[model samples]
Target: MGRLTGRQKLGWAVIAVLVFVYALFPVLSIFMTSLKSTSDIRSGTFLPPKVSWENYQQILTAEGGARDLFLPALRNSIGISLIATAIAVVLATLAAYGIARLDFRGKKLILTTALGVSIFPVISIVTPLFNLWRNIGLYDTWPGLIIPYLSLTLPISIWTLAAFFRQIPWELEQAAQVDGATPWQAFRKAIVPLAAPGVFTTALIAFFIAWNDFVYGISLTSTSAARPVPAALAFFTGASYFELPVGAISAASIIVTIPVVVLVVLFQRQIVSGLTQGAVKG
Candidate 1:
């Protein structure tokens, strides 16, 4: 490609700045809101009159505020999201390997079913799942949320990993086996390293899905026993029935958002490479 002229470079720079602001403006707004005192939040100003950590204190340490609600919900969100991500990645890696390396009668059927399930509305099945979980004594439990989360995480994980697997040369595995490695050993030492980027990317995506789920988190759990951060946010209350906990909610949102931002910034290269390679063949 030829080098860009100065005008073209300036145009592209402007577009990049515009996109960055568009994407991060809401997050900036939330951060500003989080710094506002409860009274300042209602002052209808974009910037706080005076910065205050009261909102953060309310959720993080204050007495008779959101400390109780936020802490438990944060723990539940982390534990549940991690568990679901790990399970989905392991299952998806194995399933995608089979789909990529094997020729089976039902291969296409399995892919189609996975695709269908991923696209199916979560709301549609919540009623049935709610009743079923209640009957089976799984309601308001970790497993209750984890199983439903698999339904969300698995399909996309399979699709992404399968695409990535297809791009890896089969000869590498054969070469490993010829060196006296067992099939499992060959996969563990050789294939797993090669597929690490894709697997990591898939796990992140799956975690985000499970982490952000509100309907299932709210409808399935009656208490903090299984409620995640997203659903628990809804239960935040103000000092009085007539007031709102807007600042506290914003502070909580900023806290939850920090981990996601850190992950993306840390693994951006891997995420980009994995996605690009996965898309190359499919």
Candidate 2:
């Protein structure tokens, strides 16, 4: 391909700037709101009059129950998301390997079903899951949330890992066996190394899915015991019903978003590799 002309470069630069603004606007607005005082928030200005850290401190150490509820909810979110991601990655890895390497009837059907389940509207199942969890005694517990998260995370994990697995050169496994390596040894030494990036990427995606969940978290758990941050944020308030907590909510949102940003920044390369592993023709 020929290099772009100056005019073409300028056009693309403008487009990039617009897209960046569109994506960054919401985050910037939230951060700015977090820096404002309650009176400034009532003024409804996008930029705060002055920087204030009191919103952060208020949520962290309020005399009332904000700190108690927020901290436990944060821990619940972290613990539940980690547990769901671990289980989803393990199960999806094994399932992807089988679907990629082994021949079986109805394989395509299985994949289609998983895809369908993943795309199914979560709201549609809330009523059923609510009743089911309450009946089985999984209600208001970590497993109550974690189990529903699997339904969301597992299908994506399987599809992504399967795509990556297909890109691996099967000849390497044969070569390992030719060198007198056992079947299990060949898989460990030859196959897993190539698949590690995909596994890591799947884990990240799974974690994000479970972490971002709100409907299940809210519908299933009545208290902070199993409620994630997103659901718990709904209960935040100022002094009373008349006093809304815009600043505190914004601060809490910014705090919750930091870990997701960190994870994406630190693992951008592996995420890209896993996503594009099988896209090209060899």
Candidate 3:
């Protein structure tokens, strides 16, 4: 490709700026809102009259009402999301390898079923799951949420990892086996290392899905025992029944958003490489 002319470069730069503003404007608005005092929120101004950390204090400090609500939910969100991501990545790696390497009956069916499950409406299944969980005594528990989360994360994990596995040359595994390594050793030592980018990318995607889930979190959990952050945000309250906890909610949102931003910033290269590797077959 030839170098761009000055005008082309300027045009591209303008478009990049526009895209950046469009993407980050909501986050910026939330940050500004988080800084506003409760009274200042009603002033209808985009920028706060005076910056206040009261909202952050309300959610983060033990003395505040929201602290109890936010802290447990934060813990649940982290623990459940990490557990679900780890399980999905491990299962997906094994399942995807089989699908990529073996010629089995119903392989297409498994792929199609996974795709279907991923797109299936969560609302449609929540009622049945709710009743079933109640009958089985799994309601309002971590396992209840984790089981449903697998349905969401597993399908896409399988698809992404399968495509990635297909791109990997099978000779590496054969070479390891020929060197006297057992099948398990060959896979663990040789194949797993090469699949790290794809696995990491899939785990991140799966965690995002589980973390952002609200429908399951709210519908299944009755208390903070298993409620994740998204669902717990709905329980935030103001000083009086007549008021809304807008600033507190905004602050909590910013806090939860920090982890996602940090993950992307730290693992951007792996994410990009994994995505492109799966897209193009060698």
Candidate 4:
């Protein structure tokens, strides 16, 4: 890459701003809509004349409203996503280390197969998974959702961690052994620390994939017991036939989105390192 001229840099900056605005417009619109009352929403204003907390209150406190359902879905999302992420990261770490460090036949094939599986459309498996879960008594439960989420999270975790692992200098393990460290201790204290950023980044990615899932969540779950926030939001409605719970939906959407934003902000550096490391390698 070459350094850009002043005009070129200015042009790139403009493009970046435009892209940012394009992506941010919808989120801003949703926040603005969430703050509006029903009447203000009906008026179809981009920004509300005055902000009202009624929408949030209704969703949180009203009987037969989102609170009864939303809370469970939120819990389910958090629980399932965390569980899936933890499981995926642990398995991925081991698999990645093996792929990167150990010589074995079919290693490339395994990586390629995992890549293929990761890109497989979730919709294609929904019907079959539905039937399988029902037959196995996994339908409409947390396990149903969590099991399906593995199909998505696991592959990405393996791929990213493997890339990061490959970048590690294997000589450190030997160096630690020479220093009287046991194999397990050498790995735990040496490799683990060096790979922490990549592992943390993989965890974040896996969690996001699991948390933001809507297709599997909606397809596999029938009740609030296992439904996640994204899926539960579909069932929310206004009190009457003539009304819509747009404000409440927006508020709920914002609430769920906050966690993702916070997580990204907190782990941005690790995320960048993991992604770049993975991309730079095979």
Candidate 5:
């Protein structure tokens, strides 16, 4: 079509504005709420009445005692997410490459089973997982949380990486192998490097999943010391009375969200490009 008429352009602009506002409303509301006083938060205003830094201050100071307060929980969350992502990236890349490149009997069945397990709801197995952990004395432990986290991160990471691996030309690996590299070396040298963008995207996705998980931490942790920041933040208030500063909660929320945000922000281009690389071609 030729240049849109003024009215048509105006309508399009209004639609774009509407969509943007719709998408940003929750985030904008959360930021605004995070600044509210406890009273105001309970008062349930979408916007804060007065901006006070107290909530943030309390969480940072660990007013109750600094054992596993906001910062430590933040550290724990980071550690868990990063560690899980690291484990996932390594395992998934190898698994994905193997499945995508190698031919074997029931290979389709194996990949399908892996994908099927990933599709199942986490809640279904949580109870048995909890019981198993409890019996083995693994509950409320870091590994207790990490194992379930693998169930969440690994499958999708493997699937996405597998798709990426399928896109790589087989000739590249063959060329490396012909140059005296073993299959593993061929993969390490020729395959992995070129797949860096997709790998980063996979890791970023896994990191966010592990980082954002509340279910795993909530079920596994009974004490603040063992809980991740998100779960620890929950115990800040009580049914009898809201005990802590809302600013602390606000600050905690911000603290918990920041690292994941930064990780995604840094790898945003890679994630986008990798996901979109073959979209048009496909």
Candidate 6:
């Protein structure tokens, strides 16, 4: 290997430092701010005199059942994310299987139409969906939010899974069929396990999409009983219009963020592969 000049090493180090700061700054800032009291938050220093756990306590046990909504929101977020992701995975895998394996009329057109739906603006269709939900008395409920979330999750799932399926060795499926396994059994016993990485990748994408959505959650769930964390977190504001407690808000944000971070860490390799599943030719 050729030795690098000191100046070249310094240049690369500087670039690495910049990238690290860009990624870590906001996260560090959120955590640091979460530790400060309201007064120190207003003072706005990069560092604080002390760290506190009171904010976490408040969020966990805030106003009787009202403030405790954070727990429910967290639960709802998990529940909703899991249900939506499972449904999306099943539907997307089946659809991808057909597109990747079967011969059908207008296959190109159907695939194009499926991909096209992902491009439509959510805002344009949200109002119509809200009205429809209201008429059917589904508004202000978890289903209202879940159904709309599918609109975002399903298309992306299909696209990614379809790409992944294209990368699979078709000989595996053929050999399983030759061994007398039915199509469904082959899919269940072989394809699904082999596709775990891609499925998890798709599920994470869907989960985060639903977890982080604010517009539909706010629009569809009118009360705290149904509002997810994103909507419920808005209440940490003061009477004079300024936010009530930055620390409490940060604590809440930390609580909400940890699960996604954990999932990502656990599935980091899968995500990396799934993201690049279609870039190579078969």
RMSD of each: 1.2, 1.3, 1.1, 1.5, 2.9, 2.6
**Of the candidates numbered 2 and 3, which has the greater TM-score value?**
3
lDDT of 5 by residue, 101-154 (tens): 889898888778878988888878888988899999888877888878998899
lDDT of 4 at 80: 98
List model 3 lDDT by residue over 235-264, tens digit each: 999999999999999999999999999999
lDDT per residue, candidate 4, 127-224, as tens digits?
99999999999999988888889999999999899999988889999899999999889988999899998999999999999999999999998999
Which residues of candidate 4, in runs, are more than 4 Å off? Answer: 1-3
User: Which TM-score value belongs to model 5?
Assistant: 0.87
What global local distance difference test value does model 1 have? 0.95
lDDT of each: 0.95, 0.91, 0.95, 0.91, 0.78, 0.81
Best by lDDT: 3
lDDT of 1 at 252: 97
* True-vs-predicted CA distance for residue 78, candidate 5, Å: 0.9
Q: Which residue pairs in candidate 4 collide?
A: none
Cα lDDT for residue 261, candidate 2: 97
Report the Cα lDDT for candidate 5: 0.78
TM-scores of the models, in the given order? Answer: 0.97, 0.96, 0.97, 0.95, 0.87, 0.90
Clash count, one per candidate: 0, 0, 0, 0, 3, 0
Model 6 Cα RMSD, Å? Answer: 2.6
Q: Say which prediction, candidate 2 or candidate 5, comes out ahead on TM-score.
A: 2
Per-residue lDDT tens digits for candidate 6, residues 1-282, read 999999999999999999999998998888888788766777758776787666777778757532566777777777877888888888998998888888889978877887788777777887888889889988877787778888888988888888888888989988999999999998888788888888888889988988898878777787765678887787665424565667777888988889888999988988998777755658
Clashes of 4: 0
Ranking by TM-score: 3, 1, 2, 4, 6, 5
Lowest lDDT block of 10, candidate 2: 273-282
